[model samples]
Target: MIHSCPLLRSLTLLLLMAGLTFSCQTRNSSDNTTEQTAALPPAPNFNADSAYAFVARQVAFGPRVPNSAAHVQTGNYLVETLKKYGFTVTEQPFTATTYDGKKLNARNIIGSYNPQASKRIMLASHWDSRPFADADSTQKNSPVPGANDGASGVGVLLEIARVLSQDSTKLSLGVDLVFFDAEDWGNSAVATDAYAGFCLGSQYWAANRHIPNYTAYFGVLLDMVGAKGATFPKEGYSTKNANEVVRNVWTTASQLGYSTYFIDQQGPSITDDHVPVNEIAKFPMIDIIHMQVNNLSQTFFKEWHTTEDDMDTIDPATLKAVGQTLIQVLYNEAQPVI
Candidate 1:
């Protein structure tokens, strides 16, 4: 939701500039580190129409700002949908203090499949819209519709949950779908700290997990994935903290012929929900976010954080590209020997 040079990178730069002597130590590592490939089954078809409907349903609820009636209704809809799809649902409700000293009634919705399975994969997205369109010239104080910024990622995951519920035997490992709230409420443009109010729901979840001692093999967070001609580059923090996960997802996308959207380029580190997950929860997570690498002023999509982020900006083809790639990744994963 907010973009910044990660503090880790800054500290590393400082260390390098100081010319600190570091010892080079090497150890014998296994050459056969790759997991064994199994005969893959056909993945469930990702229906773009179904995903689009999910996005539309959330948009119809208006801007899902925390503490608003629309926010509560949309949270209920997500929990109900996950239950209908046969997931063991969990809701973590909490009160979060915003950067401006306002209390937000935030809730993190989780849908667990094969809860008994020890090995699991986590997928997450923010479902709360920005309370103000701070980037827009007009209606700067008005709430953003967040059709692509908030609803798009959640929509893709909901469709995935539906497919996984109908056919549980395809993937042996468990899948957890998390819808984090209050991610877009930060005002980074005016603050010295980039990660202030952003990712409040994820920050809460990382500290107090829904399930006791919950851990996943790895996590993937989706954001702004339904815009037309969206390009997702390897974000800096993801590359720095979870390089293997970034490589895995990007390589999978390339193999699936979706290389155009998942570009092999370096992107600026964003202060998003994934940061808190990787830092606090100690999970390896990567963000599949649309960013403009060429333009510093408009790093994200043009409509990002703007009132113009409505249903008209969402593209079904973009949704299909991301959703299908995820389906491939999740289904292909073998149960790790944990």
Candidate 2:
């Protein structure tokens, strides 16, 4: 995904230059309500080593680019892994014609926990690595390893599934972990308003949902979540569309003593997979992505969309922060809102 607005990025820089805090202006008003949401039962431990291993496994498959053997192998591995955790898995296969006119075979993989429950929440991450590392100085056409951009988020969710499997009690709401495919095949030159080819799997799934009239209370999409020294401010689109969910998540992260990573800052708008999930599916969703106003070259992490986004870029500590926060969020939502 790309940072959607240069103006917003500039504004963030100006604010930082002016010595202003990057917090949400309206956060105080809803703090009480969000605080209530974060005060639920404690979540199970999120193992960083296990999550790291999962990330390594995905990277081991090489780049999971569309229509490639590695892509098919990784897809099968994801399905089998989800099934091992007792999730009801479904594969929604489709053909997506990208902006450059490449017809790619893609599938959005879904894993449902507590499928019978009416109340539900969605967690998602793009599973396919970018076909080209355009951001790299050399090897501009080579495939991205996607250790942080793709695999990290999936690894976190997979660990969540494993942790949930070990828990004894039933959750309060159903959970859907969606591994979106064909998300990184678009032309990076015109990524923002004209990013039609990006996030193909989500766009398709939103229009032609696997379940008839399927809906969720809220959703969260994770991207670029395992980079070293990564910071996840509240993304702009999420604040616009799913402020309640953002407030709760940020509050929970702070409560868990991770305020450093999950800051109170408001990040730039990102054109990512969650946009379709919000606009097309008509479900409020938020994006937890790594964006830095401090980065001179790009708003994303240093290795974004580059061949350098390999296993060396993956940070176990960063993974633990995001994974643990997500686990806390889910367990918190497992309790009925008071």
Candidate 3:
């Protein structure tokens, strides 16, 4: 969920500048480029059904509202599943106060593959569903199922982890799959301070990184990515903050014949978790979120923050498009000098 308020608009621009500086520096480094092309691995097969099943599992757990029993249980499920997939798991537990003055017991789950490699990429998604279906006309005050909003991105990442574990020898660079909590507990649209309440877990992680001095080649965030016939236009903040990263991912998506889904159009600026990661953590991060150019509301996907965000709205094809694109991107990156 996002509010395009004037104050947030100004802050978004400043954040974009800071992100561009870091992203440009990374791309300009001579070490990142090589005259001789390296032999890239075959693209790993992305299983859409597996990804869809993962999304279903999250929805089956019910709405994972922060501080709720479902939220805690779902966190445990993520940790155990990642461990099963041969990832080195770490949990960052913290307390955050929301705009409504409620204290949340939040946890950020980190899963690492090939931790020994210096060249790394970070993939992230918010796991907690929004507590209110403010965008639903019928159930405006109810909690959302968030099958696409919260679970879709994590489902894709979990499937990636499973594939990586199955064929560990194929990967050349390290991967960190992070599932952030309390991302959807922000204030409703009617609130006076909407932006302040959003992305609580990401803000905490940015200020205090799980690993000291943690750095990655680049980071990609997925949100509202599992809806049927979803289209991921170039988000405004991503274009301003990490244009190169956006180009890289969109290029890969096009090459994979996903051009129809990853359209080359500018999307509205959103104050998501990636915003804090770009501003505070200084990571060259971009968001691959669903947006519609012709929609009545300018914020997000059709069923966003609504009770209709249930499993039926999720599509395996969209998950495959995004998951396959990331696999291709990682496989193309040159291994860092040890």
Which candidate number would show the highest lDDT if scored against the true structure?
2
TM-score for all models, in order of appearance = 0.86, 0.87, 0.85
TM-score of 3: 0.85
Best by TM-score: 2
Which has the better TM-score: candidate 2, or candidate 3? 2
Stretches of candidate 2 exceeding 4 Å from the true structure? 1-40, 190-193
lDDT of 3 by residue, 1-338 (tens): 34355664687786887798888888776334332122334667899999999999999999999888889889999999999998999899999888878899999999999988888899999999999898888888888999999899999999999998997456878999989889987765544553558898998999888899898888999999998889999998899989999999997787677988999898888888899889889979999999887777555777888899999899899999999999888877844445
Tell me how many residue pairs clash in candidate 2: 0
What lDDT is reached at residue 308 by model 2?
A: 91
Which runs of model 3 end up more than 4 angstroms from their true locations? Answer: 1-41, 188-194, 334-338
Clashes of each: 0, 0, 0
Per-residue lDDT tens digits for candidate 2, residues 209-272, read 8798999989999999998989998999999999999998998888777888999999888889
Report the C-alpha displacement of residue 63, candidate 1, in angstroms.
Answer: 0.3
lDDT (tens digit, per residue) of candidate 1 on 95-168: 98888889999999999988888789999999999999988998999999999998999999999988887875
Clashing pairs in 3: none
- Whole-model alpha-carbon lDDT for candidate 1: 0.89
